[model samples]
Target: MELQQMRYVIAVAETNSFTRAAERCLVVQSALSHQIARLERELGARLFERTSRRVRLTPAGAAFLPAARQCLDAAERAAAEVAAAVGEVRGRLAVGLIPTVAAVDIPGALRDFRRRYPQVRVGLRVGASDDLVEQVKEGALDVAFLGLPTTARLTGVAARELARDRLVAVVAPDHPLAGGPSVSLGRLATEDFVDLPAGTAGRIQTDQAFAAAGLTREVAFEVTTADFMDRLVGQGLGIAMFPSASVHRLTGVAAVEVTDAPARVEYVIWSPVGRTPAAAAFLDLLDLPGPGGSAAHAARAALGTR
Candidate 1:
């Protein structure tokens, strides 16, 4: 029987009189009597022995009483759990990010967001942009930071452009093109390119730029991870192209300005299928000015770069 029916049976058993039980349950006596009668009929057994002035439990009623109480307790516990999940901010939110985005600004920004919303339990996952897109689409992640134009048409998801990330040249300190104010596209043509893999947005941008400059890409090595790309460049493997944000000094790589490359726009991609309040809070966090958000001012203060 239904949980409400169990509750009705329990109420009638607790109070001896039908009228008293209905008053306690905020139902009319006849309605309560009818519900108990229906329950007894469904079970094919009498639950109570009724007299003119009093109601007492039958053998079947005594057997069912504990079970009825247990059913109601379970139902109430389930309801309370649902209410906690909905009303509280302290639930798990799985967030995904690509290496470059995670390395650049997201880590610091997330640290700040965690400090602000400590009640939220965050689960962070890092992967390639395409992988993160797939995770978001498959409902594996609540939210993700990825490059734009996700496979939403194929998978039913959407993206919002959060910030613009531009490409820049990266190389070792002793490289031949290192001393220039700005290396011309024609001059950069001769250097072997330590490149990103073919499918990545940065790689596509580099391919287009090289084609426009009438320069052929002398493929040096294919490195996908931003950290590894910087490391490969630092070891004098060849010059690599990456978003300016990943230019943070980590593995002895040096970042230089590349004016001719296409800009890489970073976007926040997520599925709304199972969004929680914490996920919305994360979107709001993206709009706030955290550590490096005012990059111009923060950069000037840190690197003294004009």
Candidate 2:
């Protein structure tokens, strides 16, 4: 069967609508339907069970989906390899970033990478640490910057420790604990907290720290962005626990060290098996030494460079 037919099937399975899949594939609906029909005739197996209301993959479709995706990925990698052989780093690199990551100068790194490899295309996605991690695992992203537990490991990926920073207590300047050198989780047990949602790495780390301390704080606001959470804490709505770097520059919020909190580690993680040339170049930039020069040096120390 043609590679186009495999693509059409995969798109239909992902979007669950022939019309939408056709739109995504940039073809007319009738053409896409005809191609799928031809593919099924060639294979003698129906790939989808369609109704006017919805589309669902058949048992056969489910069985074929993973292989279809692998085929597409392999084709793309082959093309990239040919370009790399010519000393060109030309391919799409999808990078994921967590909103609260502060150890890396991502914009600077991208700028330098683009300057060096003008032919390479880059795409960026920002999400929670867990979501970004999953995207890396699913091949939607080539690499991701994540805040993971010190000892936590993800299956099927290789990670490099970029930086280690302490989780701190964030409070409004006027809050009672603002002037403290450090605060204990036990002391904040009765205070209202502004926190990230349950599935995020930040929230998970905070929860574990509280559990370890035998204290539980009331969460008054669940914010998705670190900047918004800083504003919430500044408004005196509640306090929060966040990585120290995330709150270092807040105008009205004070980030006090959490004397008993666990340290959060930032990692640059990627699939070691299918790394693209662009990904390899970017990772090399992350290793270059310097403190504040080019993007390559912006977070160099975090990458364990001298």
CA lDDT, every model vs. true structure: 0.67, 0.80
- TM-score per prediction, in order, is 0.60, 0.83
Candidate 1, position 248, lDDT? 72
RMSD of 1: 17.7
Clashing pairs for model 1 are none
Measured with C-alpha atoms, the lDDT of residue 249 in candidate 1 is 44
The residue-by-residue lDDT of candidate 1 on 1-306, one tens digit each, is 777778778778877888888898898988888888898999999999988877889999999987786566446434433534444343446788877662237777669768866766778997777778778876667678775322223246656666666667777889876766666566677888777677765576677777878888687788777778777778897888667776674567666677676566677766644344455555555552222222223223222233
Q: List the residue pairs that clash in candidate 2.
A: none
User: Model 2 off-target regions past 4 Å?
Assistant: 249-252, 288-306
**How much does candidate 2 score in TM-score?**
0.83
lDDT of 1: 0.67
